[model samples]
Target chain A: MALSLAQASDVVDAALLKARELGLRPLVITVLDPGGHPVVIKREDGAGILRPQISHAKAWGCLGTGSGGAAGARHATRDPAFFAALAAISEGRIASSRGGALIRDKEGNLIGSIGVSGDRPENDEAVAVAGVESADLVADVG
Target chain B: MALSLAQASDVVDAALLKARELGLRPLVITVLDPGGHPVVIKREDGAGILRPQISHAKAWGCLGTGSGGAAGARHATRDPAFFAALAAISEGRIASSRGGALIRDKEGNLIGSIGVSGDRPENDEAVAVAGVESADLVADVG
Candidate 1:
């Protein structure tokens, strides 16, 4: 795992802290390694039952497309057929939204990504960015 | 919804602490609410690629059988066909192993469960017991 658990934990912690500051709804946050496997996941007590899967899907989109969820949303709009096919291929594990971003190191290397759910898309994206920056890494929100 | 993220986080922390003390292989620990939904999951950096799913499966067995994973193993041994059918029914999400236990409050009420993967089943179960106790809960290993 190129992305250590400590780093992934930090990302999730920062994201949760940001969510608290913004007074957003409870969230489920997931951090995925570059290989698209989950490293850490934390769901707030009141998060919807499905938020965990949604969180994973948001990040899965970024991993599969080499683009952030925002970019995924754009692609979905520009190529709806392709994006729909992707959803079917991944068995509904990819989604287009604003709550996901690729984590990049100082050297511009992809390490992982963070995905958040349970708030407005923009707020979710904001929290994800906070997480990456808190770890001293760049967030490629695409 | 009876399990809070704090409790689940503590379970993962204590399990990891136990794993470190034993010098065991890296592990993936999963805490699932009684409803069989994941509340927290942590995969160590060097844990096997399939550990997350295995951890979840171990916990799922506990939730589905209304008994600990050890009981599931016993049932598997006593009635292989029944257990095999169970595995097929859940789409391979239920497993018989020693690393899963139902978590109960001091009053013997069910709360959630903790599952661990990476080391031998006994070692994994030991770490899970440590985690449940650390959270001031009892381990119902069945």
Candidate 2:
């Protein structure tokens, strides 16, 4: 099943609200569809001007690397040439760094991805995961 | 001096290479000039295609906000109303999110920005810094 834009936006809103309730300060949130395309993004107030881009980057990284955003770095470290080739083949679309996660179903099918930025990497992960969980989607995070 | 497309490509290449070496996966790397315009971008093979756009969005976000990149998100949080207005005025040019940073000179002059996507917020920051360091440019990460 594909994720609708409304659903994606709702997920982002839920995640941001959760972050605020937890006093996590402003955040950069993004949601991607099953193909890793951004559906919508929202930057919290005081989150900074760079937050939106950062959030999109993280989400894109997760979708590109096919793993949680933060884990992309670890994947790259395990294989350099392969990573380079991957980057090359993707036409500079794949990244393995941080602040992102793969969205999945309970059956383990890759559904989509979500990424958060503008705060601690761990915190970013938390907010993203919260959105996924709230959406009743399984978040494959490490 | 404006950064050439080749220079932007080099910045992204170096950043991705370093990120791979660091064992991080899921990163999106982007390079921009002093005007916060995209010069080059590489998304990695497995990285989602959306990463490239996210990188661009982050750089534009910084330029629109006049807060460089790092501090933009924080500013967004403190002044949501103003930020919203700015975002509206910029027509989605300003982001004020995470995963973006301002490129600086040794003298702390803002040269441009480097935005990283597909990773956790902090991890993205690290990779962006690596890209700038690879180019031997100064960076104000805020």
Candidate 3:
């Protein structure tokens, strides 16, 4: 089954709650369905205007690379030019960052992705993982 | 107040329901916040692959012009050159079509917009209007 809108909202809400509990800064979160289309997006009141764009890019990168954002960053490092070109082609919707994680169903089927932006890359990543787990879904951070 | 994720999902669901009731073909719908940022997007099974892109473009056009998609099309008709340049500048994220409608709050404040694709332009706009009203929001289709 595809990732439902309700599930996507839950993921964003759980991610925001985790960020608040951790005392992280305002954040923007985006969840994309398996088809790489946004299912839900939330930008906290104080989040930077660019946060939404960055969060979406991270999630799109995860979907495109078939891996989490961190892994996409590593892949970019090995071929920066290619990735850079890809970003241009995609209108900057591909990010090589550490704040995106793959979402999977109980059977380990890739369903979608969650992307967070605001705090340090590691903190963003941590919150994204927490958010995924809170929804009883698998987070493939690897 | 900003459009919440719940509201966005509700709009999508309502739109899909209306499409079903009308016996229209598969559709893709997109909702964008006031800032022209995506809130949610849904593509029904069997929709064309390009439906999402078209839906987003229609919503973005409405947001950019501060008018519904039908109005934007009229504007384009008056100045095709300008609209074409705008499409190029936006990297195809703006469409001059009739499948988009402005979303407003009870006080008539511009909140966001919804765009639907799949059926004829008029049919798409009709379903979008039904969906927005179903969510207890105003639809500016003129």
lDDT of every predicted structure (CA atoms)? 0.90, 0.70, 0.86
**Candidate 3: pairs in clash:** none
State residue B81's C-alpha deviation in candidate 3, in Å.
5.7
* Predicted structure 2, TM vs. truth: 0.51
Q: Write the per-residue lDDT of candidate 3 for residues B74-116, one digit (tens) a residue.
A: 8889999999899999989899989998899899998888989
For model 1, residues A15-95, the per-residue Cα lDDT tens digits are 899999999999999999999898999999888989999999998889888998888888889999987798899999898
Off by over 4 Å in 2: A1-142, B107-109
DockQ of 2: 0.10
TM-score of chain A of 2: 0.80
Model 3 per-residue lDDT at B52: 80
Comparing 1 with 2 on DockQ, the higher-scoring candidate is 1
Write the residue-wise lDDT of candidate 1 on B29-141 in tens digits: 99999888889999998898899999999988898989998888888899999988998999998988889999998888888988889999999999999998998888888
**Cα deviation of A27 in candidate 3 (Å)?**
3.2
Top candidate by lDDT:
1
TM-scores vs. true structure, each candidate: 0.98, 0.51, 0.77
